[model samples]
Target chain A: MNRFKSFVIKEFYHIFRDRRSLIVLFGIPIAQVLLFGFVITNDIRNAKIAVLDYSKDDISREITNKIVSSQYFSLAETLNNDKDIEGIFKKGRVKMVLVFENNFAHDLENTGKANIQIIADATDPNLANLLVSYLSAIIMNYTLDMNRLAVVPMQINMESRMFYNPELKSVYMFVPGVMAMILMLISAFMTSITITREKESGTMEILLVSPLRPSQIIIGKVVPYVLLSFSSAVMIILLGIFVFGMPVEGNFILLLAESLLFIILALSLGILISTIANSQQTAMLMSMVALMLPTILLSGFVFPIENMPFILQLLAHIMPPKYFIIIVKNIMLKGTGFSYVWKETLVLIFMTFFFIMLSIKKFKVRLE
Target chain B: MENQVVITSKNMIKKFGDFVANDHLNFEVYKGEIFGFLGANGAGKTTAMKILCGLLTPTSGEIFVGGFNVYTETEKIKRSIGYMSQKFSLYEDLTVFENIRFYSGIYGLSDADIKMKSNNLMDKLGLSAQRNSLISSLPLGWKQKLAFSIAIIHDPQIVFLDEPTGGVDPITRRQFWDLIYDAAHNGITVFVTTHYMDEAEYCDRISIMVDGRIEALDTPFNLMKTYNSENMDGVFLKLARA
Candidate 1:
């Protein structure tokens, strides 16, 4: 036990002594979360749009008032003719254009349906999709309110509601993804580099010939990183909750425990990397190219895995972070309990076991 | 000096697939003697040393280190041996005193023993003034000497030095031999490998390896006479050439 203590203390000396990576360790989570929260988002706030109403009726004016009253869209221009839409969109001043066809209110009352065109600029397709959805929801809400007062029982009004996040704040989605990515990169990258640094410096040979067992050495390498990755995970969660007004609807303790499990999984990946790489550079490259790329791209952190190609969907299933992100999203956003996240938690546990066993076997091969 | 064996190997062989690294090696290292392992580059000197240190298993041989079987009692063998690699293995980012203290602690030294031993070591190495200085700040020669001291900080039965004096100045090399002689006199067996022939002259007995086999094992005086050479370097050149 004392030998293990000394070994861990020595590992800390290496971490604290290297000032560059120390900064990176604490800096990445904060910077990435803030960037993802504020800069990269799908939230539609005061989206610029133009209105082209050919009817000039009270109902068309009322619907226009309703759309503009919502915080999501702001009236950027009033187009006098339909010919100006292509020109206005070419000017890039508005993300969408709201067009009401001729005799909109007359058509609505007589036929129980009206033709209103919602044109969106597809240059930034995600933002355009979001703009169209919000507009459609507003129109749907207005029609529902009208139907409640009408005496016609044969009208079919379609109503759709966004649950959990009624306002569709993008931070709610990004916080869990950022947590997954930061934990994987910090835990795996740090552990692999530390072990490979010892090998590169030739201290590993001395450690091997000493009284310390291989298990002790491998454990000592990972314990410090687990602590670091856990602390960073806490920082990200706090930022999401306090800074971005993101909610933690479920048990906070369960969320933290799950984060720790994922951290250990990443650390096991780090150990596996260290066994294969003989130099610090190779270890770092392998961790980034093998671990970080998959965690970011295939973990459903940014792109929706269901929307991916059939082969990538299969590939995403193999990524451990995909399950972690699901677990985090369920706990923080959906207000779910362990009963809901149990299958994901089991997958993470199995992956952790598999990585650790493989790394131990590989480490033994290296020793021999 | 010649008969109390601390390390014994009988017909040890290590092969990486079909390539023989230490082919049918045989030797013994006696207690309280400076035994030198001399070899050309890639002559498998490190492979044999690794086996003796219990870091590698011999392909098929009988070996004992510190009276413990290499295969069955590797942990016990490791506890009684100190190793210094060709690269200076001290943590460069740590202070001189911290490196000493860490090494002592890992060897399972008590806190009181650690405090006492590091003070004595720093003073003896004439590094009392640099206790708080990082190892990387010191000169190369000083670093080499400090690494050697740390390797034997736990007072193991035998210290294995794999080219411990590589790339150091001549004066420091002489002082390093003095430290080895002092350790031997204090009943610590020294098993060292070096490329310097003059360093071989300081060993009580030297084993010369050529092409994964020990070609000669004897006192430097006997090796000089057998090869009809004036010095250890000429004898090594003739043997390595053959």
Candidate 2:
């Protein structure tokens, strides 16, 4: 036990002593969280818009007011001529351009036939689609109100409420994803590198040649990484709570227990990786390519798994992060307990057991 | 055989898939003797040594280390033995004291015992001043010497040195043998493998392996006389050519 203590202490020394690893372990997560939260977001706010108001009428004015007041689009300029639309779009600050035809009020008053032009930048197709829908919704609402002046009519209403994240704070969603990513990196990636480092330096052979069982050697090497990953999870959670306004609504102990489980899962994965890799460089490359990228991409940390292609969706089902992210989201946002997260818990448990068993088998094969 | 024999192997064969590494090799080392297992590169000396050290499992064999069966009692065999590989097997990031503590820990030593033995070992090695220094900061000779000291930190019944003096200077090699002599004098069996023929001559008994089998096994003087050669090297060259 004393030897195990010193061995774990040596692992901690290796982790804390290296500047590049220290930065990668802690720096990237926090930076990604903050960047995803405040800088990069799906919700459009204050989008630049230009208007060509040829109608000079009450309907056009009301529609413009609604668009501006919705806070989704800001009116950047009132274009004088149709030719100026291209120049304004080329400037590229303006994402949308609205052109109201001449005699629109007269045409609507007589035959209810008025034309409106909505031009959008097709460079960013997703943003363009969103902008088109937003402008159309505003104009439709205004037209319906104007039609009410003539007669009262039955209408369809669509009422929607976003659960948990009403304001759709992207940071709230990213906090748990960041926690998973950082924990996996610090636990699995770092542990594999450190273990392979011992192997490369020939210290592992010495330990093996000693009285230590292979299981004991692996455990002693991985225990410190699990603890470090746990602390890293805690740190990310604390940063989310204090720095960002991320709320943890579920039983705090359940959340911590789940985090600990995921950390173990990642550490076991690291051990499996180290067993397969002969060098520290190979371990690092495997961790990045096999674990980190998949954890970020296929785990629904950044991309939605449901919306992925068929094969990728099938692949994402096996990624441990996908389940972990669901558990975290349920706990943090929906305030659910084990009853809600039991399925994800089972998947994590199975993955952890699978990885650990695979690693033990691989280690035994190496001893042969 | 109460401490009479340190290691015994009969028809030991280590096969990886279809390739046999230690092919039906028979060997034994007596207690309190320096038995050198000699071989050229890839001659399976390391493979045979690994089996004796409980690091590798033989496919079909009867192997015993310190009178304990290797297949079922590897742990017991491991506790009774120590090993230093071709690469000096010390954690370079750790201090000399830390490395000693680490090895002793795997052997399940108490803190007080580790403290006591480390001091005595360092004093005997003339490395008392370098105890607190990292192994990386030490010279090649010191690292090699320190590796040997830490290998036997638990004071095992036998120590396996696998080319322990691979890259050290001739002076260091002589000093390393002094340490080996010290271990042998303490009634510890020294089972070593080396490519250096002169080092083989210093052993009480030496086995020369070529092509995965022991081509010759006898005392250095007896092997030279049996082969009608002047030195151990001449005998090795003759066996290697054969």
Candidate 3:
């Protein structure tokens, strides 16, 4: 036990004595949280757009005022001629162009319908789609208000409610994702690099030749990283709560317990990686390519898994972070309890056990 | 001289998918003796040493280190022996004192014992002033010596050095031999593998391995007389050429 304690202390010395990794350890979580929170968001604010008002009527003017006042858009240029709309869009100063057809008010008054053409830059399809939807909603609201007194024969009222995130704040989605990503990065990447560093530096040979069992050595090497990753998880959670106004609606203790389970899963994956990698560079490359990319792309962190193709959806199911993100989202946002996340927790536990067993078998084979 | 053997191996064979690394090797190392294991690159010297150090399991062998079976009692063998690899095994980021303390502590040394031993070790190596310095900042020779010292910090019955002086200057290598001599004199068996031929002359009994087989095993004087060579290097050249 004393030997294990000393071994753990040695591992800590390796971590704390290296100033650069220390910065990466503490610096990355805060930077990622703040970056994903304030920057790198889907919430469109003040999108630049040009208005081509050909109608020159109070209704067109009022619609333009509505778009501008909604805070989702800011008018960059107002065009008179139809040719100017193309020029404004080509200059890239605006992301969208709202064209009000000539005699818009006259048509609405006589036929109860008017044409409003929305020309958006589809270079970014997602942002373009969002902008068009926002513009259409504002115009639809105007028409509804204008014809409020005229009773329709049959009308179906569709009231859509976004549970947990009523305003659809992007930070609510990102906080859980950032937590998954940061924990995966720190736990898997850092642990793999550290263990492979021993192999590269030949210290692993010395450790193996000592009285300590290989399992003891691995556990000792991993304990420090587990603690570090747990702290990083805490830092991300605290940042999410205080800085991004994210709420921990579920049991806080359960959330932390699940986070620790994910950390152990990542750590075991790291050990498995280090077992296959002979050098630190190889270990780092493997972790980044195998763990980080999948965690970011396929874990439902940045992309919705349901929207992906069948094959990619199948691939996303294999990623540990996908289920972890689900658990975190449910616990933090919906305030769900153990029953809601037990299946995910079990999968994480199984994965951790599988990786640990695989790594131990690989490590023993390597020694032989 | 009391020729009490501390290490014994009979027909030791290590195979990696039909490529035999230690092919039916047999040798014995006596207590308080410096046994030199000489080999060319890929000559299986490291393979044999690793098995003895409990780092590898031989496919078939009857091996003993410090009277403990290498198969069933590997942990005991590990505790009874110390090892230093060719790559200096000290953590380059750690201070000299810390490295010593860490190794000693892992070997189950008490806190007060570690303090006293590390202090004495630093003073003995004339590195008291640089005790707090990182291992990377030290010269290669100092690092090699310090690694050797840490390898034996627990005072094991046998210490294995895998080319301990690979990159050191000749003078430093000579000084390192003095430390080995001191350890041997204190009843610790030294099993060292090296490519340096002159180092073979310092061993009481040397075994030269060529392609997983012990091609020659004897004292330097007897080996010289048997090979009809003037120096250990000439003997090695003749055997290698043959």
Off by over 4 Å in 1: A102-114
Q: What is the TM-score of chain B alone in each candidate?
A: 0.98, 0.96, 0.98
Q: What is the DockQ of candidate 2?
A: 0.64
**lDDT score at residue A257, model 1, on the 0-100 scale:** 99
Model 2 docking grade: medium
Q: What are the interface RMSDs of all the models? A: 0.9, 1.7, 0.8
Q: Alpha-carbon error at A247 in model 2, in Å? A: 2.6
* Stretches of candidate 2 exceeding 4 Å from the true structure: A103-115, A137-151, B1-3
| Residue-wise C-alpha lDDT for candidate 2, range B19-57, written one tens digit per residue | 888888898889999999998999998888888887887
Tens digit of per-residue lDDT, candidate 1, span B21-134: 998899999999999999999999999999999888889899999999998999999899998988979999999998998888789999899999999999999999999999
Per-residue error for A182 in candidate 3, Å, reads 1.6
Which residue pairs come into collision in candidate 2?
A: none
Give the per-residue lDDT digits (tens) of candidate 3, residues A41-70: 999889999989889899999999999989
Across A1-368, the per-residue lDDT of candidate 1 in tens digits comes to 88889888988888888997787689889999999999998777899999999998999999999999998899999998989999999999999999999999999989988999999999988788888988998988988898889887677766556798887788998999989898988888888888899999999999999898888889988888888889999999999999999999999999999999999999999999999999999998998999899988998888889899999999999999999999999999899999999999999999999999999999888877
Best by DockQ: 1
Determine the backbone clash count of candidate 2.
0
